[model samples]
Target: MGKIKKRLKNFKAPDALLLICILMAMVSILTYLIPAGEYTRFLDPETGKEMVDPNSFHYIENTPVGPWKVLSSVHQGLVESAGITSFLFIIGGAFGVLNSTGALEALISRTATRLKGKEKLVVIFFVTLWALGGAFLGNFEECLAFLPMQITLCLALGFDSITGVVIGICGVAVGYIGGVMNPFTLGISQQIAQLPPYSGIGFRLVLWLATLTVTIVYIYRYADKIHKNPQLSLSYEVDKASKYREEISSNIEFSIRHKLVLISFVLAVIGIVYGVIVFQFYLGEMAAVFILLTIVMACISDKPVNETVNAFVNGAADLLYPCLCVGFARGLTIIMMEGHILDVIVHSLTGVLGKLPSIVSAPLSFIVISIINLFVPSGSGKAVIVMPILVPMADVLGITRQTVALAYHMGDGITNLLSPAEATIMVALGLMKISYGKWIKWFWKLVLLWYLIGIIACIIAVNIGFGPF
Candidate 1:
């Protein structure tokens, strides 16, 4: 027993999968302790969207998940999350086909060689590009398609996978926080709150600029540190073992095939943006674009049909573990859902936060929303769940609905990278081979910094009456 106790004491560093399972178990247990409750959902006639009626929350029968259900929920989680898991697999397979042609490696090598002394500029450009995509296009899962290429680019530029993650995940994260014109969060949120769409642009632009600047600086500093001393990087060991094809000659020629493949990739990105903006493309449409791009890229690189098929299969196989992470991470939410405790937690949060003074409540809303986002990672989904309650609460607390909206936006964005249940983040970490524990160790400080910025922004919004109302 002493030996077992000693072993337990020494146990450390659970991986993403284990961490997710642990979370599922904890949430399952909470189903009993925390009474099951739900808010009556009503459809907004004007917006034709469902909104949770905050005042209608009432205790319901507890449906606690047993140990067997905890295990079964993992499979149920995968089934429920089939859309995203399959999306990950398809993206993985598509990149698999692309990688087999060596076009991505060749492009990275050529670009890295030419910009050897200008790595800082490259990081800034890509980060800004990703931020714009997120801010304007409401990109979240869409960014998954580019992780392999992004990670390769970072490695080629003498940075680690975490650097790539920051550029992609954190950059987009700040953009989501900014919500300058993000239809997903900002638009859905304002509509639910019965405010004009994109109504508070002036202040939102400021919020965007502040968050973007800090993010850029933070990423640059980290990249600079890791560049100066590789050992300083949290991802140093995992990155060292990464199969990034670093030995590729920098002087490798950018042949016609490589150029064609790269051009096709560029066109594919443009297509995705246009589709999203003009036609309201979601996962299905985006996946189709990637599927087509995969074929175009393979054809351009002159990969034989059989070879391409094999490469695609192998590539998809390589990502099997990471894709599984997505499903397992979803199981956390599934457990909470099966146990019927999600709304109870949401109702509890709003109930507590509603009692605070506006001055205190406005900023604290960020914290409350951050906690709530752990259970509901979907931006639009959370907006529906919390906005109805927050809107009325804001009126009583003498704060603008816009302030609460801002709180929702910033809190949701910041925690996306931090939430273990966020499938996209888990998938990104898996692709980079970074453990969730390591990511948190490296990322918690940045999250704190972002929270500070967000809280200050919320306070200012409250003071300035940031609204067109």
Candidate 2:
């Protein structure tokens, strides 16, 4: 027993690459055990995307995945994920070039000086802002653009790197759960369920407030502890390099070139956000903006052509590991889909939930969505895939469609924290150099708390008849 406890304490997360491989291999095995099944797919009139028809469930002949095919899926995943993989590369390279300029550190130095004594207030403002973004706008991938900057700020503000990364991710994550007006998750799910647009937002707003407050306070408490006792941080050992940053002296001037590059980045981010929300730009377009920003930064700095090109290339190269991890993660989904077991798993899980009591079924719906989301992480995509089946299932079980949507929103939101298959989350971890194991160790407590609150909220929503149906 003592030996067993020692082994458990010493366990570390498998590297990102190995974790994806293990999961992919596990999923391949499941294809054999779970019967092959499928639901008919049709285009959604509103979203102009293909959606599974809930009533179209049917079992087909088993399509067992072979070892050779499973091995081949690694390549297939990269091919399928080419678009996102490329976008991640550009994101890394863009930030890498910016880091090379030392602008973020300079800016953090200035900002940290102003907030010298108001560290808790600083945490509250940024965490709330990001949470609002996730709750109101479905801002998951877009939020990744801000983590590196936040890491620098957190370190400068006397917090550890984990605190920096958490501040960036946790709020948006909570907001994803609250999902007040988030189009990607709740909006699409509700619309598919044939409910009123953004119905039950009053309750959602309350959830958003409650969740945001919990996360903010949680992050602050952690920040306060680590700020005083730096040794207490999970990232403390690896953080020394980032923690004891060379203090930027107040008298040292930020050069004109640094200001130009920094201003261009800020404007570029604002423009990208507007383009994404208003013009509906996606991964490809976002990549273009960063590519453009890289050129602008290079030119404005008046550096030699060789230096600029080298910096851009090196920056992109630095992100190679995370980008490959995204490909492998995408491959896992490909293998499942190729083996024709994706629908079967969904069918199996929902069938079990459909038999439970309404209150129990409602909370289990959250768990089911969370499971499926590991295979399908895209917000709107998951909504399209699962909501069709879950919406109707909820009806027969006497569960509200609004409640189902809430479950999907909350479940999907929470899994994004731990899903290595998620592109932005992977890169966000890459930014901090934190392994998945370390993150899980530190993060599971907050997630457990959120889980409790989520179940209780779902019960309340069901009791009070949350819906426009």
Candidates in order, TM-scores: namely: 0.96, 0.94
Candidate 2 per-residue lDDT over residues 176-253, each given as its tens digit: 999999988988888888888898989989988888888888889999999899999888777777532546556545
Best by TM-score: 1
**Candidate 2 lDDT (Cα, whole model)?**
0.83
Worst 10 residues of 2 by lDDT: 243-252
RMSD of 2: 2.1
In candidate 2, which residue ranges exceed 4 Å CA deviation? 45-47, 242-247
On a 0 to 100 scale, what is the lDDT of residue 210 in model 1?
Answer: 85
- Candidate 1's C-alpha runs over 4 A off are 1-11
Q: How many angstroms is residue 416 displaced in model 1 relative to the true structure, after the best TM-score fit?
A: 0.8
Error of 1 at 74 (Å): 1.0
